[model samples]
Target: MPSRKPSASLLDSSQDDPSPEDALALAEQAEAEAEEAEAVAAAARARARAIRLRNQAAARELLAGNDTEAETSSAESTVTEQAEPTETAGAEDADEAEEKEEEATARRRRLHIPRLFWKVLASCLAIIAICALLGASGFMIWKHGQADHRRQLTAEFTAAARQSVVTLMSLDFNHVQDDVKNILDNSTGDFKKDFEAQQNDFIKLAQQSKVVTESTVNAAAVDTMSDDNAVVLIAATTRVTNTAGAQQQPRSWRVAVSLTREGGQIKLAKVEFVP
Candidate 1:
């Protein structure tokens, strides 16, 4: 085939498809896309490189430290971000855990009662026991007081009887003085020696003065008495006749007497004469 020049019409048609400005703009666009792709590839490579560097730094820190520090670094420590908050997160976590535990502990502690309750219970019981004991003691004291009053009444009655008996002895039984003396020598005697002696003395005195009569006994009631371990005291009053020589007049004389117990029976101790 012979070399020939291309037709200008085909050249013109092809030229019409793309102007110079359009071609230049397309070239510029392609170059900008290429530059953007190169920038993205570089960014990805840098990110990968940074990740590798961080991992290496962590491993190095772990290796360089002791067992405790290595564990700390291996767990969460990083060369870049290590200084930022190593203890803050752990301490915060610990604080939160401690706070929760303390709250739980407080709740548990509230359910337990103190020893003071038992002590209070014991004290109350002791107080009640003491009150009961005191009440019993008071009752006993009241009972004893009543018994003492009864004993005092008995003593008064016995004193009256003893005095009455002594007064009786001084009456018309002037002839009975020797009989009383003999009775004193016998254990089976109705009266004790001091009692008989006292009676006998009064009888002898009454007969000597001749103021006695048989009606002396009939004019009165006599005798009620008691004794203590050591002694007895008594009181009495009496009426006796004073006679004139012709039996024409009989005047009455009043007498009072006190007696005391000696050797287990009442003895004449004193007398008061009343006219």
Candidate 2:
């Protein structure tokens, strides 16, 4: 048997049936899309309104200049001034632009540290230079005084050198005991160890140390110094007792003695011998 031809009713039912439910669903979908679109449009308008307010504030700040004090006071007090929609949208743009510029200027000022550092550095260097000059002057004065003292000491020693040294054969006194001492000194005069032997004789005499009429430096002949040490003698003379030890003999000598200075004090160094 031939299949029944597709009836008009069957064909109509296959087109998902012309039902009210489908129409209702389409209506609900259209309403939801309309609500979403309206929300999005409202958001866009809100953002535009915000931009407009900011630009208006910038415009006012620019055009206002230093207007009347009362006008400025009123503008500051009027909170509604910003909330009120401007007739022109320029106020919103101006506010945001000025805010960015002011922030940039503040950032520039904060980052520029080199100028302040240079100013402080210059002041410090000036102070250091002044201190150095003062220190140098003080040092120079100290050095000059020290040099003067050294030169004076050298001069004194040079003048005293000739008188502190005398012939080994000669004794400052002429007593019998001193006579024998003189003979012994003369015997060692030409001795091979003349310098050492003379010192030994003087040391023996110094041990006995008889005042022997008071002996003074007669002459000094040598100048000796080691590093900072110096020697000098100023004056010399000789006197001696005779056979009875009562009579006196006198001799005059221009003399200087070796003196060493340590820590600014003059010390007896050596008896200078004159040639």
Candidate 3:
């Protein structure tokens, strides 16, 4: 019969049912697609891993460079700080050395002044000593000369007094004129004038009395002596033989003799007898 318009269910069931070859081919296609998808996913994962590894390596390199820069900066700062201290020490040392040199120079200058002053003082003292020595020597020479002159004056006065006493007391009446002349020659000043005024009388008396006298000086001493005048004390004993004396009689006489220097010669100025 119209074969019945074939039932829809059958037709549909036939369409749903696949052939063996077709089923096999589909299974193969599905498996192939799955395999392709698996391959693509694996490729993507490999690419992402490679990219991450590259980024990590780049970051490590940047960090190493920064550490190196920091270390270099620290080292430079340390070196600079150390160098600053060394420079300051060197400057201080130089200043100390200069100060010491100045102090030494000042000490030398002070020492030099004292040495010069001592030398000048020593020279002055030496000059003063020499002058003092010369003055002392001159004084000694003057004193000795004065002592010698005084001694000579004393000797002269003594000798002159002795001679005058002997000559005046000793006389020879036979040569009365000559004896008188001798007395006159030795006499000067007041003694010479008085004796000359009585010269004739003395001659007459000596002749009439026939007087012969001998005299000796017992002692003579200088009482006062000066440059131009002197006084002498003369003690003498005289033996007289005359008309009034009967025989030879001894008489003691003490006479004060005054003398004056005339042109370096001692002459009698006066003769006085003392009781």
Number of the top lDDT candidate: 3
Best model number under TM-score: 3
RMSD of candidate 1 to the truth, in angstroms, is 13.8
Instruction: Write the residue-wise lDDT of candidate 1 on 1-275 in tens digits.
Output: 12234345434654557667866766676677677778888887788667656655554454445347457544444433432354335434654675698899987776445566777899999999999999999999999998897677466534544544443444444455654554343211233545655765766766776664422212322233334221233333344553453332433434443444556554444434545
TM-scores, all models, native as reference: 0.38, 0.35, 0.62
- How accurate locally, in lDDT, is each candidate? 0.52, 0.54, 0.78
| Comparing 1 and 2 on TM-score, the stronger one | 1
Ranking by TM-score: 3, 1, 2
lDDT of 3 by residue, 170-271 (tens): 888999899888888888998999999999999999898898999999999889999788999999999888766676668899999998888878888899
Considering TM-score, which of the candidate structures 2 and 3 is the better prediction for this target?
3
TM-score of model number 1: 0.38
RMSD of 3: 26.9
Clash number for every model? Answer: 3, 34, 0
| Model 3 lDDT-worst window of ten | 1-10
> Candidate 3 regions off by >4 Å?
1-96, 243-249
- Which runs of model 2 end up more than 4 angstroms from their true locations? 1-104, 111-113, 166-257, 260-268, 271-275
Scored against the true structure, residue 275 in model 2 reaches a CA lDDT of: 38
Q: What's the TM for model 2? A: 0.35
